[model samples]
Target: MKILGFRGNVDPASYTLSDALPNFGRASGDRSHAHSGSTAKGRDGADVPIAPLVTIAIPTFNRAELVEKCVRSAMAQTYPKLEILVSDNASTDGTVEMLRAIDDDRLRILTSEENIGAIGNFNKCIDEARGDYFVLAADDNYYRPDFVSKCVRLIEDEPGLPIVIAAYDVLVVDEFSKDDRRTVPARLSKKLSTGIWQGTDILQEYLHGRISAQLLSSLVRTDILRRNGGYSPHPCASDEATWIPLLMEGRAGFVDEPCATYMVLRESLTEGFTADKRLGDLREVLDELSAVTAKKVSDPAMRERIQQLLNRYLAYMAAVNLVIYRRGGASLSQAVQKLWGWRTVLAKCSVTDFLSTWRLRSIVRILSPQPLARWMAKNGFDQWV
Candidate 1:
C-alpha cells in the first residue's frame, strides 16, 4: 500500500530509513511482518495486543531539517496499524521533498498548494485523517516508542471515550548552548490521578489552575473530535482552547507517564517569538479561552466560576510570562510595574492554591530580579517561559 497522499505501492518490510540521522534506529520498527496487522512489542520485547489504525497527522511549515527527528519518532512506534501524514503548509523550503524521501509505505506527504496559516493547516490534518484514532503531533516534539500503545488500549477498551492524555516531558534547551538540554517532566495535578477522568471534572480542574500540563498532544477518538468542531483555532491559548469543546463531549482518560516530548524552546517562550509563531499576550489569550468555555458549557454558574478562575489564573500566568518575557531584554522595572498592576488579583489567586512547592518558586521566580532566572532554573525549579 502507498502512503496517504502519495501514489505507488511499496513493501514496508524492506523499507529502511537512512542511517545518517543523528539517532535513527532508536525508534521502534514495523510491527509483525509489515504493519499489515497489529502486533506490538512490549517493554520486554514480548508481543502485546494491538488494535485499529492510528493516524499521526503532523502539521509543519518549513523547518525541513528539524522535522526529521519528529517523523522518525512516529515511524518508530511499536504499536502496529499506522498511517503517518506530514501536512506541509505550502513550504517553499523543500519540506515536502524532504518527507517524501522517506521510503516507508505508511508515511504520506500531504502538501498544500498555498501556505495556509497554522490553524488552517491543523484543521486540514483533522479533516483528512482516516484512522479510528488520531494524534496531531507538532513537528518539533518526538514521541516515545510506546506513546500510541500506552494510551490506545485504554481508549479502545472504553468505546466512545473522547480522549486520552499522556503526560509529556518538555525538552528545555539552554539558550547559550544547544548541547545543554534537559527534559523536564510536565506534572499533572494530583487531583487528576491516573485512570478515567470525567469531563466536568477535567473542565473544572483545568480551569481552576489545577492541571499544569496541556491537552495538545492527546490521543483522541477521531469521530468524537470531528463531531465536536475539531481543534480550537485560538492562537494564544489554543492549547487549552482545543480541549474545552472536546471535554464537553464526555469523560476522557489520562496516563500519567511521559509518552511524548513537548519542546519548550526559549525562542518561543522566553525570547517572545519563534521564527514561525508569535507568543501572544496571556491575558488576551485567556479572554478568548473564557469565551470558548462560555459557548461550550450550558450551566451559567459553572461558566461564571470558570471565568473567574481563568481571570485569576491569567493574572498568575501573565505574571510568570512577564517575568519570562523580560528575558527578551525587556525592562525589569517597567515589567515589574506591569506585574504590580495585577497585585490584588495575584494575591487572591495565590492565597487559594499557590502554596504548592513549584507555585511558590514560580512566585519567587517572577518576583526575582532579572538576573536570577537562570540561577532558579539550575536550583531545581522549572523555568517555564
Candidate 2:
C-alpha cells in the first residue's frame, strides 16, 4: 500500500478514517496552481462557484497490486472534496485485504458476495456514488494528483457543461517483465486543445478516432450518467454505448494538459480480445448506439448525420478486424468469414459510402485477399494503403 506523490511516509495505522483525507492547501506543485474558492469565471466570463464533490468509482477484479496503485493515486488528489469508491467484484487474490490496509476516510469500499461481471461491477459503483460529479476509474489505471482539481475547474468555468475531458498519457506495462514500462502520448493528444466543444462535435471527434471512450479521462455529471443508465451490458464497447448518449445530451469541456495515465497491460482485456470477438462486440455496440440515437434525436437531418458517422466508424472497425485477422495468422477462409459476417450487418452500405467513410485504404484492405493483405502489412506498405 505504498502511496505515490505523498509529501512523506504515512503509517495507515496511526490515523483514523476522519483524518485520512489530505489537506491539499495552496501547494506550489499542484497542477491547478490555484486555491479552492467559491467564485470562478465561467466560459462566458460570468462568476460561478468552484466547489463541487467528485466521486471516482474504481471497479476492480483479481488485480491486487495494480488496484492498490490505482487507489493510492486517487487518494493523492489535490482536490479537497473528493471520494474514492472501490467496488470489488469478489476477487480471490487478496484484493480485499490490501484495500482494508489503507486508512482513508474518503474511500468507500463495496464488495460483492459473488463474482459479478465487469459491467455489473461498474453499475454497482455508479449506484453507490454520492458526488456532484462522477468518474469511472479503471483498476489498472491511475491519475495525476491534479486530475480532479483541473477537471472541476473546467466544469465550474462552464456552468452548463455536462462533462470535461482531459488529455492523458499512455502507460504500457509488460506482462512478463514487471519492471518494463513505457509512457507515450495518448492518441489525439496533439489535436485536443483547451476549450468547450459542442456535444455533437465531440461525438463526431470520437467517431473520427480523435477522442477516446475511456471514462477515466472524463468527469461527468452524476445525474446525467444515472439518467443515461450508466454503462451498457454489451460484452465489449460498453463504454462507447454509455458515453455517446451522454455526449449527445450536453456540451463537454476539454483540457489540454495530460492529467491521467491510461495503463495498457499485456494481459488486459483489450489485448486478449480476438478479431472475431472484437467485431462481434462492436456490432452490438453499434446496434445499441443506433437505437439510442433514433430514440433521443428528433431532427431527421441530425439523426442522419449521426448515422453516417456510425456507419463510417463501422467500416473503420471492419478494416481493423481484417488487419488483426491477418496479423494473427488466421486462414483466408476464416478471415473472409469474419469479414462477410460484418458485411452482412452492413449490407445496405454502398461502394460510395464505404469509400467515403474509410477512404481508399479501407476499400483496398476489404477487397484484398488475406494472404495479400498480410504480405502488404509485413512489407510495411499496408500502413499507407
Candidate 3:
C-alpha cells in the first residue's frame, strides 16, 4: 500500500513550538457580534452563556487544494472569538504558500520544517490551541458556516459538558468523475436529543455504532483534552483512543444537525488500507481501549462486560476483513490462511464463534472466485465489503 500522506521521513527535532507561533493581526470582521453575551437554553431549561473563545485546529499534510477549502470553511464560522490554526506538516505541495496567501487575520499558519507524521501534527495542534473549546479539523474536510456557532451554543448551554459530537454529512466525490459528487447525511443509529449524557452512556452508544467517533465531528474542552493527553499515536484509531477516554472522564453533549462535510478521497489513508492491515489496526485500537477501560473501571462486572463487548467487536471486524480480502481478490484459501494466523483475531473468538458470527451469504461471498466477487462489487450489488 502507498504511504499515508503525512508519514513522510523527516527529523522530529526539526520542528518546535517556537517555529509554529502565530503573528497576531486584526481579522477583517467585527467579531463583537459573536461575543454579545449570547445565552441559550440548557437541557434543564435554564439560561447558559457561551464560552469566550473557540479554536479550530486544522492539521494538514500535502493536500494543498483541500486544505484551502478547509481553512476557508473554518474562517467562515459565525462564532465571534474563533481562531483558525493551520499546522502544516512540512508539505512540499505548496500548502504553506496557499495559507500565506489568505489575508484573514483570524487565520494562523504554523510551519514544521520536517514531516512530523499525522499523530505528531495533531498533538501539536492541541499544544498550540489557546481557546476554551477546540475542534480538530481534518485538512480534507470542510465545515458548514454555522458548525462552530451551533456546537458552541450546545456546550455553553450544557455547562460542564467536555465534548459535543455533532452529526456530519459524507461528501463522496466520484473518483472517475470529480463533478459527479454525492452528499449524504452520515447514517447514525438513532437521532439523539440535544442534551448532556454520561460518559459511559456515550461510550456504549459509540461501541454500538449509534454515534460517530470522527474527530471532525467533535468539539472538545481544551483543558480536559490536555489532561487526558491529546490524540493517541496510533495511526488508525487515535480518534477513538482520545475521545473514548475523555468521554469517560466527563459528560458529553450531542448535536443532531449535520454540520461538517467529510470528503472520501480515493487515495486517503483510510481507503488505502488492505484488509489484513485494517484488521491489525483495529486490533491495536481495541487493545488500547481495553487497557484504558480496565484501568478506569473498578467494577468487576462492568469490566467483564467491556471484555465481552471487545470480543464481539473483534468478531464483527474479522467478518468485515473477510469481506475486504475477498474484494481485494484474495482466494478463499489465501484469505482463510491470512486471517487464521492473526493472533488477536483468533483470540476474539473460536472457530465456532467465527462461523456463527457471520451470515452464510457473507461467507459465500468471501469464498467466491475473485472474478465473480469483483464483478459483483463493480456492479454495485455488494457495497459493504
Candidate 4:
C-alpha cells in the first residue's frame, strides 16, 4: 500500500469558509502563496476575492501516458494558488506508478480500491476537492500553461458559475498510434463571440444547443458544482446538466484564445453517422433537456421554445445522419425504419432547422462523391464543427 498525502500545496493561513461547509479532514497545508484579500469586480458588479485556491481535478484511469501529460500541463499553470488532484479510478496500468514519480508538491493522487465508473469518479473528484474554485479536466487533454491564470481573473461569483468558456484547439489524432500523437490538422473550437459572453440572456443560447460539450473545459466554482448534484447519468448531456443552471442563473466567462487542446481520435471524427452512438445520444439529450428546462427555467414561453429548439436540433442531427447513412449503403427499408422511430421526435421540430445552411451542406457532402465531398469540406463548406 502507498499513500499520497494532501499536506503539500494548501496553505492553512489562506484557507477560509464563507458561511458553512462540510469538513473533509484535509491535511494541513504549507505553500508559498497567501491570500492578499484583494477583491476584484465580478460580472454582476459585485466585488469578489482574488487569489483563491483553485483545484485542477484530473479524473483518470488506465491512460497512464496521456494522463501524465495532462498532469504536467496542469503543473505548468502560471497560477500561483493551485492544487492538482489526480483521482486514480483503480487503474491496472502504470498510472499510479507514473503519478508516484511526479515530484510536484501541488500534485496529489487519490487512489480508489475499485473502479467507481467514470461519472462516479467525476463526482468523487468534486466531493474530495478542497479548492475554492475547481476544474474537472479530461485526462487525455492538455492545457496551455496560462490556462488557469487567465480563466481565474475572469471568474465572477454571482454564485454557481459553472464554466468559463475558452477558445481551445482540437487535435484530431489516431487512437491506436504508438504515440498518442497528433493525427490531423489542428483547428480552434469556438462557442460564441468572445468578451463578456455570459449574462441574463445567455440561457437561450445555452438551451438552443450552442454550448456543446466541446467547450466543457473551463474553471468552475466548487460549492456550486456540489449543490447542483455534480454530474448525473445524462450519458448524453452530462456536462450540460451540471453547468447549465449555473451558467443560466449566474454568469459565464470566455477567453478568446486556446486554454487547452481537446484531443479527438481521428476515428471518432471521421466515422459514419450510424457507426457512433450519436442518434441515441441525441434522443437522450432531449430527455435530459426537458428535465433541466422544467427545473431551471421559470417562464412558460421560454420553456416551450427550449423544447422546440431541442426537438429541432435532434431532428436535424438525426435527419442528417439518416440521409448520410442511407446514401452511404443502408437500404431504403432500414432508413425508413429509423425515420419511423424518430417521427415523434421530429414532429416537434421547426422546418427552419432543417433548412439551415449547416444542415444543407452536410447533406450535400454525403450526397456528393467521396472526392468532391472531401474537397468541399476542406475548401468552402462550413466545417465550423
Best by TM-score: 3
Query: Any idea what lDDT model 1 has?
Result: 0.59
Which residue window of length 10 is worst by lDDT in model 1?
A: 1-10
lDDT tens digits, residues 8-94, model 2? 001100110000112112111111212245765544354534676788889888889999999999999998888788988799999
Per-residue lDDT of model 3, residues 52-169, tens digit only: 5778989888889988998999988888788888989889989999999999988888888877766677778788877767898878778989888887776766654678877676
lDDT tens readout by residue for model 1, 53-78: 78898888877876778899999998
Whose lDDT is higher: candidate 2's or candidate 3's? 2
Extract clashing residue pairs from model 1. Answer: 28-76
Q: Identify the superior model by lDDT, candidate 2 or candidate 4.
A: 2
Please list the residue runs of candidate 2 whose C-alpha ends up more than 4 Å from where it truly belongs after superposition: 1-50, 175-184, 189-192, 269-274, 298-300, 356-385
TM-scores for all predictions: 0.74, 0.75, 0.77, 0.73
* RMSD after Cα superposition, model 2: 11.0
Model 4 lDDT-worst window of ten: 1-10
User: What is the C-alpha lDDT profile of model 4 across 45-147, one tens digit per residue?
Assistant: 5444566678888888888988999899999999988889898989999899999999999988898897766666776777778777778777877888988
List per-prediction Cα lDDT, in the order shown.
0.59, 0.64, 0.63, 0.58
Q: Rank the candidates by TM-score, best first.
A: 3, 2, 1, 4
Model 4, global lDDT: 0.58
Q: Of 1 and 4, which scores higher on TM-score?
A: 1
Candidate 3: list runs displaced more than 4 Å. 1-52, 175-184, 269-277, 298-302, 350-385
Evaluate residue 103 in candidate 2 and report its C-alpha lDDT on the 0 to 100 scale: 98
